[model samples]
Target: MENIFFPKVVQAVAGENRTVYAYMNDGSIRLVDMKPMIKQGGIFSQLEKDTFFEERLTVLNDTVAWDLTGEHDPTQCIDIDPFTVAECPAVADPLEIVG
Candidate 1:
């Protein structure tokens, strides 16, 4: 029997150019660019604001999420699927290079 691993985001850091660095439980970091989604408007419109996008960035439901209400309620947050995030190419820790 083979064990299936499900990716879960343990931490998330908002970056310039509307990118998010997702730190996964599998010890991998995935970069998610939210610009495409934000361009689609609707619920994603709120994230268009740079301050709001960075401030609300968080990890919820084990994935990258935005806490719109600042209440930390999973139901009220906008979250990306962990599997979708995991599909992104893995990258080295950006913080390491910056520091």
Candidate 2:
């Protein structure tokens, strides 16, 4: 989780893109998915539709600094692109996104 949730807090720049982390139910922070995206595919399409999160943590005395990510990320676990996530974010996270 240290790598995901416990990272140092950062600010969102108007013209900058950076890594934002999320916390899992396992008391661990999820890892970043640096994989490239698929241009055209059903899974890819879904990722493009989900809402991703942008969150901040309480820096008082927490073990790992993580809270609910702001938006949603459909592609978080699936093998697809961010666009698929942008489509449907409210759906529960699945352990596997494959058929």
Candidate 3:
């Protein structure tokens, strides 16, 4: 897919069922359902624990990131590509974006 722009993530909230609400620089909010990605295993497997998954999410480098703490290598941080995540169907309302 051709992405003309990569929206900078401004905020995010992780919700149950592996859903993530991403607020982007374009002023559009997208709900990213990660259950399918997590099922693929590998680094995403670390998020199997609901508490860790929900509480550890952060916005970094204009994208949703996880494992930013010292326990994990900074370079190993798991994040979605900003270009790929941009232009997702927007949520109807900002308040409805919450997990």
List, residue by residue over 1-99, the lDDT tens digit for candidate 2: 366422221221111132223233343333333223323544433333323212322221222222233223322233212232222223233343877
Clashes of 1: 0
- Displacement of residue 51 (Cα, Å) in model 1 is 1.2
Q: List residue ranges in candidate 2 displaced over 4 A.
A: 1-20, 34-40, 46-99
* Candidate 3 per-residue C-alpha lDDT over 1-99 given as tens digits, one digit per residue, 9 for 90 to 100: 987765888888875588788888888888887888889999899888877787778876678888647354547578888766675667754465566
lDDT order of candidates, top first: 1, 3, 2
Best by TM-score: 1
| Pairs in clash, predicted candidate 1 | none
- The TM-score ranking, best first, is 1, 3, 2
By lDDT, the best candidate is 1
- Model 1 misplaced stretches (Cα beyond 4 Å): 97-99
Query: What lDDT would candidate 2 get against the real structure?
Result: 0.28
- Who is ahead in lDDT, 1 or 2? 1
Candidate number that wins on TM-score, 2 or 3: 3
